[model samples]
Target: MDQNKPFVTEFLETYKRHPALWNAKSNVSKNKHLRNLGIEDLLKVCQEKFKDANTAFVKRKINNLRTVFRRELNKVLKSKTTGSSVNEIYIPTLWYYDLLSFTTEDESGRVGISSLDDDTELQFT
Candidate 1:
């Protein structure tokens, strides 16, 4: 196995300059509402959704989750602190990004797109 040198500084360094470390395209979310929300909101939603999961055993499965979350969250904050204009949070490299785009079926079940560009007028069909 190769040693992952990415986090040598515990990710204390800004990742914006690193292409492999910071690719915004990786974090596309299909749930536009959820995608628009920041990380804190996302966590709150997750907490609420899993509120009833109070089993100690099950919770223990995520023993190191908080630390990992904290580290990742801190990295995001740092990124913003350094003047990153990227309003939407993208996933880390080599990770899956939730698709934010929505598709619809036309009269013949053919897929249709809302709009691909920034021009909002074209999105309305």
Candidate 2:
């Protein structure tokens, strides 16, 4: 069995759920085509397509996907744990870029902001 099968399955499912991730037509056939690429290529495409889409909704969706990815990754790690020869884990760098681009903190640490919209003011929480 392919080791990355679970990760690939989860990624394709998530990719299909978001119409914004589609390259051209947002349809099942097109999405299947998109899923043919490797994980790294998929992340690169998503990063390029949604780079400037920094609205609150988009950010929230991306963050949600990140959370899902992390959870799935944990499952993978748990399954692969052994004496001392586990394979090194790897994720696309663009995934981090997409999630972290809107995050920022100041020295005061009072204000937490993660939206790119100009009208959406950063509030202290």
Candidate 3:
């Protein structure tokens, strides 16, 4: 077996123990809440959603994830306004575990996951 497999497995197991980290129902519910909001309102919603989660660790992780989300959305909006290609946007090099499962509407304004599906949009709000 690979030397890193056990460590990786343990990490995944530890992560799974946190319900708020990848709760699909919660994600979908939040996505619904986000669908009607504009960008700034969306950022506010993301900040508020995880305010009451059980642990400081989880709260901090959620906050970090929210920061990435806001940054990505800002990039997308800037590119759109400048009439630049959306492909110019790039994902940050940091890892946020499976928190990347959130979804974002594409440049044409359709709400679907794209090749860059970093979940920057759906993860927080």
Ranking by lDDT: 2, 3, 1
Cα error, residue 125 of model 3, in Å, equals 44
> TM-score of the candidate numbered 3?
0.33
- Number of backbone-clashing residue pairs for each candidate, in the order shown: 6, 0, 1
Residue-level lDDT of model 1, residues 1-125, one tens digit each, is 03323232222222222222223333343444433333333334334445653434223422333345445556665887777678755344311111101111111344678655656454455
TM-score of every model?
0.24, 0.25, 0.33
lDDT of 3 at 83: 67
Task: Let me know the TM-score candidate 1 reaches against the reference structure.
Answer: 0.24
Which lDDT value does model 1 have at 13?
29
Residue 34 alpha-carbon offset, candidate 2, angstroms: 24
lDDT of each residue in 1-125, candidate 3, tens digit only? 36544443443344444433444444533564333222333333333443443344444544555567567666656767876666765444434333343423222344665766565565555
- Provide the lDDT at 111 for model 3: 62
Which scores higher on TM-score, 1 or 2? Answer: 2
The candidate with the higher TM-score, 1 or 3, is 3
CA error at residue 53 for candidate 2, angstroms:
9.4
Candidate 3, lDDT over the whole model: 0.45
